[model samples]
Structure formats: C-alpha cells, structure tokens
Target: MPVVSRFLGIIIAMYWDDHAPPHFHAKYAEYEITVNIRTGVVEGKFPKRALRHVLEWYEIHREELIENWELCQNDESPKSIEPLE
Candidate 1:
C-alpha cells in the first residue's frame, strides 16, 4: 500500500492494482475503513469523528484521488496528497 496522505494520526493509502470503485484505505490505530472516492461512502470500522475527518479530506481531494486511482490501475505509484490540517 502506498500512503497518499496522513494527518491527525490517520493514515490514508491506496494499493497498486486495487479493486474497483476508486477507493482509499484510512487506518487509525486499530480502526480501518475503505472510503469510496466518488461517493464518500465508507466500508469497515472507524471512529465517527475520524471518519468525518477522512470524508472532509476526501472531499477536498476527490480529483487527486481519481487521478491516483488511475495511476494505480496502470500499476504506477500514486502521488502524495495534502492532508487535512
């Protein structure tokens, strides 16, 4: 997994050649969630407040997320995105 962003102890990553729906993984401590880039829907477990942070970050970087998704689909390394401050 390539870490694309990190802030507030939340680690956001995306795997090379991952599955569909253009999502990224957000991991915090023992909690991890997969967030769909286009819809902002999350799968798996994460704190509500943390999830909110993730969603806010995602909203700000949706275009970059999609670009990274394309890069991953092509087996290319993804670029780092700015984290929520």
Candidate 2:
C-alpha cells in the first residue's frame, strides 16, 4: 500500500493490484474504511465526523484519486494528494 495523503490524523492509501470499484483506504486511529473514488461510497468503518472530512477531501481530489487508482492497478506507486485543510 502507498500512502497518498495524511492530515488530521487520517491516513489515505491505495494498494497495488487492488480490487475493483477503484477505491482508496482511509485510516484514522482504529477506524479503517475503503472509499470508492468515483462515487464516494465507503466500505468498512469510520467515525461520522472523520468520514465527513474524508468525503470532502475525496470530492476535491476525485480526479486525482482516479488517476492514482489507475496507476495502482498497473502496479505503479500512487502520487501524493493534497490533504484537506
């Protein structure tokens, strides 16, 4: 997994050769969730407030996320994304 962003204690990552739906992983403390880059649908668990932040960040970086997803699918390292301020 390559970490692409980190802010407010949240870690965002994309895995190499990962599954479909083109998702990225978000981890905060003990919570970890996989969010689809296209739809912003999340799978797994995260605190409500934290999830909101992640969704907002996703909205801002949707295109970048898709690009990174493609890179990861080809076994390339994902580039870092700007974190939500």
Put down candidate 1 lDDT per residue, 1-85, tens digits, no spaces.
8999999999999999789988999999999999998888889999989989999999899999999999999999999999899
lDDT of 2: 0.94
Q: For model 2, how does the per-residue alpha-carbon lDDT over 1-85 read when each residue is reduced to its tens digit?
A: 7999999999999999888989999999999999988778899999999999999999999999999999999989999999999
Candidate 1 lDDT (Cα, 0 to 1)? 0.94
* Predicted structure 1, TM vs. truth: 0.96
* Candidate 1, backbone clash total: 0
Name the regions of candidate 2 deviating beyond 4 angstroms. Answer: none
> What TM-scores do the predictions have?
0.96, 0.96
Worst 10 residues of 1 by lDDT: 33-42
